[model samples]
Target: MVRLMRALREERRWIAAAGLLFLISAVLGYFNARSLDETLRAAGVWERLERAVSVIRADPTFLKAFTLIYWNNVKAVLTMMGLGIFLGVFPLMALVSNGTMLGVVLAKTAQKTGANPLWLLMTTILPHGILELPAAIVGAAYGMRLGMMAAWGVWGLVTGGHREVVRHWRRLLERIPIVVVGILLFLLAAAAVESILITIVAK
Candidate 1:
């Protein structure tokens, strides 16, 4: 636990930076949803309805991969930005993006329906959405932490100002796989929830 805390502290800056980016994305989503209020009201929201439905109907594999890639890319960006925190940002980004996606969906649903919209979500996404969203978000937060560690580790190597740099760098390298596997595990949890839970709820 102490080691983990140390790791987190060492990579705190990277995490903070990545968090800002993730929060920005969420804010963008909310703003877009609110802007579409007029458009949705004008179009009777039926048009947007099809597009929204298409999100599920379209090539699920492609959608999943695209989404996954989006998260991974952000993770990579943050990790690189981290300097030597030795964190893997891919997993972190995945989690954050998924959470954002779910938030967008939930927000839109509530806006259009003027209520909780929990029934629809329960039928269409629950069970799985619940599992998947949490897993992804947790994975993302952890991944972001790892990426920052990698960044700091690298920074330490170059500057060699701090005695703890080398030690932390090695820790970051060792932690990468742990973080990667952690993300994958969450992905699996999400998948199971989506597959079985979504279908059952729909029925």
Candidate 2:
């Protein structure tokens, strides 16, 4: 954990870049959410999200709900990282899609509350979102890094044959700890806040 934190701290620039990417994605999503159905369709996770929502509504215990939410987020964060080897395309899309979902939800919430969108954002998302968004950005950043490694690995294979590719693979493996540990810790905090603190406040 200490090593993971240190490594993430060292990559402050990358994290900031990732944060900027996240905000850009959110802005894009907000605009796209003007056509909510289209944006949701593009996201392609509405069915799974529906099921998750059902579970959240049905589950009586906070632990069970938290577990469900945590694992789903874990899968998402991992997908962002794993698919990043596709040269970061998937991670960027995921960010945009998620941001779109947030926009749609916040829009609906604002409508229901008869409040401004920014007020709805502040009341509903700002708390856990602070932790969750950075966690996601870290996942995307690492995925983008992995994609770069893969690109370099391919370049190495073409130019230097196997040796350079092997070196790139080794570097990629060494960096996995920072991505995994950082995402896990941040998401855990986000989940706890969303399920416990936010829920309590909402009531």
| Best candidate according to TM-score | 2
Error of 2 at 79 (Å): 1.9
Candidate 2 TM-score to native: 0.83
TM-score of each: 0.51, 0.83
lDDT minimum window of 10 residues, candidate 2:
194-203
Q: lDDT tens digits, residues 4-108, model 1? A: 445445556655655566556655555576654454457554465566446645545544534543454345433443432235545545445543555566678
Predictions in order: lDDT: 0.53, 0.76
Best by lDDT: 2
